[model samples]
Target chain A: GQQVMQIPQYQHVQEGEDFTTYCNSSTTLSNIQWYKQRPGGHPVFLIQLVKSGEVKKQKRLTFQFGEAKKNSSLHITATQTTDVGTYFCAAHGGTSYGKLTFGQGTILTVHP
Target chain B: EPEVTQTPSHQVTQMGQEVILRCVPISNHLYFYWYRQILGQKVEFLVSFYNNEISEKSEIFDDQFSVERPDGSNFTLKIRSTKLEDSAMYFCASSAAVLAKNIQYFGAGTRLSVL
Candidate 1:
């Protein structure tokens, strides 16, 4: 079975602080997707990385995919209270079709 | 903006009882999935449904678990004999395109508690 491991299971950051979370998969992935789940809410899609060694940004958030396509990272600059949530990296196209293997997730807590 | 809808936001059942979690995916979506999350634990994938059949399933989906598209608008997951470990939040997700490239929209989830 393929496994996706995430680092810094929990993060506590003050307002305007920067935060970064890393994710690694046991197997290479064709594409990796990032999702955020706010407190007491469902997971919402954020962004997806498809190419090897690709970098994409959404406002203050930056996402990077490793050259091998087996690792990824998400960095947030100047965190805000609304950034408090659990971030998960989901992988697809390793050995299954129409299926996604999600990492354990990194919970981010931004304090004002 | 379409959303996946789930019924019975919470369910309480005795051990060994049967339970069914229902979901209504986005109208134009073609792929469906079921995942579960224990309190304070990671989300675990259960199964993926496509083309009126199961395309993939995790080891956790055994004979005790079954999924069915009973109608044009309904997808159901049935647990034959529930156990304490089955207590968790079950989420139903759907995507408009092939999974590898499409994003899945998840429901609020159904919290199942087995006493």
Candidate 2:
């Protein structure tokens, strides 16, 4: 069975601070996707990285996929009150079609 | 922008009663899935449905669980006999296709509580 692990289960920061969450997988993945779940809301897709050693950015958020395709990271340049939510990284293996193995999310708390 | 929609934002039932959770996935999507999350826990996959049949299911989706696509738009998950442990937020998600490049869109989940 494949498992995805995320580091820093919880984080707290003031506005204008930077935050980063790391995700690692026990098996190599075909692609990795990042999602954000607002408090009491459904998970929303943010970005996806399919190529090895790939990087993508959306405004203040930067996402990277490792060269080995076994890990990924999401970094926020400056935290805002609106960024308070749980960030999850999901991986799909070569044989898993669209089924995703999600990591234990990193809960980010941004204080104004 | 179309989004997945789920019915009965919250449900309450007895321990041994049966319950059905309903979802209407995005119209153009081809893949459907069910996931559950306990309070303060990670979301766990339950089953995946495509072409009016189940394609994949997790151990949690045992004899007590079943899925149905009765029509072109509705996908439902039925629990034969609910238990206290069955309380959680159940989410329905859909993807345009079964490719690594496709991203899933999730609906606001149905919260179920078994007393």
Candidate 3:
């Protein structure tokens, strides 16, 4: 079994402030994926990191995978009110048949 | 863009009753999955289906739970005897087979409340 841990269960940031969330896994991960779930909505796929020390960005959001491949991070710059939601990091092992184990998630609240 | 669809946005049932949640995955996707999220919690994987058979299932998908692809378009999860613990939001997701990274697209979910 694989365990994924995320830090800062809750985060409150003023609009235009920056926010970051970290995710660590108990075992080596083949790949890590990030998702965003809005209030009363299902999880939406944001991006996935496959290579070690990989960094990808989507607009104001930047996603990074640790060099060891067991950790990852998501940083949002100049957050807007629309960034209010929960960000989750999920991963699956090499043998898993597409079964994704998700982290507890970081709840982000952007105050206007 | 196509999307996964779920039926009955909300369902309420009594304890010991049987309930079925239905989902229609993206037509072109080859893998289908079901997950549950207790309010304010992370999404937990339940089962994964491919080629009309279950490829993998988690411990939570025990004897009380079963999945079936009765038709080409519908995938269903049935709880034989529901308990209060079964109350959660059930989400169905689908991913394309061509990609190595299975990016699952989830449906809005069906909130089940067991009284």
Candidate 4:
């Protein structure tokens, strides 16, 4: 069985502060996708990382996939109140399509 | 952007009763899947459907649970004799294809509470 683990299950930060969440997998993944779910809302797709050592950015957020393809990270710079939500990392294993194994997720709370 | 839509955002049913959750996946998508999340827990994969058949399913998707693509536009998940443990939010997702390169789009999800 494959397992994806995320660090800092929960985080509380003030506006203008930086936050990061790490995800590690027991098995190598073909691709990793990031999603954000607001309180009492459904999960929304954010970005996906495919190549090893790949880095992608979306404005204030940066995502990185480790060289080993077994880990990934999401960093938010100067977090805003709108950034408050649970960030989830889901991994798709080699040859496993349309199926995703999700981590426990990191809940980010930003205070103004 | 096209999005998946789920019916009955919230459902409450009595034990031993059968319940059906419906979803309309994005048009032009060929793959569909179902996942569940219990309160305060991680999202768990339940089953994946393609070509009118199940491609993969987790241990959680047992005989008690079944899925069907009744038509070209609708997908349904039926639970026979619901139990209290069945209380959770069920999400319907669809992707353009069952490939590692494609991304899945998820629906708002249906919250089911079995008493």
lDDT of each: 0.92, 0.94, 0.94, 0.94
Q: Write the per-residue lDDT of candidate 4 for residues B1-115, one digit (tens) a residue.
A: 7899999999999999999999999999999999999998889999999999999999999999999999999999999989999999999999997778888899999999999
Those runs of model 1 whose alpha carbons end farther than 4 Å from true positions after fitting are none
Give the DockQ of candidate 2.
0.82
Given the true complex, what DockQ would model 4 score?
A: 0.83
Docking class of 1: medium
Pitting candidate 1 against candidate 4, the one with the higher TM-score is 4
Share of true Cα-Cα contacts across chains kept by each model? 0.80, 0.74, 0.74, 0.80
Q: TM-score of B chain for each model?
A: 0.98, 0.99, 0.96, 0.98
Tens digits of per-residue lDDT for model 4 on A32-77? 9999999988889999999999999999999999999999999999
RMSD, one per candidate, in order: 1.0, 0.7, 1.0, 0.7
Residue A16 error for model 2, in Å?
0.6
Q: Enumerate residue pairs that collide in model 4.
A: none
Clashing pairs in 1: none
Model 2 C-alpha lDDT per residue in residues A3-111, reported as the tens digit of each score? 9999889999999999999999978899999999999998899999999999999999999999999999999998999999999999875676578888999999998
- Supply the TM-score for candidate 1: 0.97
- Candidate 1 residue lDDT tens string, A1-112: 7788999899999999999999998788889999999988788999999999999999999999999999999999999999999999988765576677888889999889
User: Which portions of model 2 miss their true places by more than 4 Å?
Assistant: none
**Would you give me the overall lDDT of model 1?**
0.92
lDDT of 2 by residue, B5-110 (tens): 9998999999999999999999999999999999888888899999999998989999999999999999999999999999999999999989888889999999
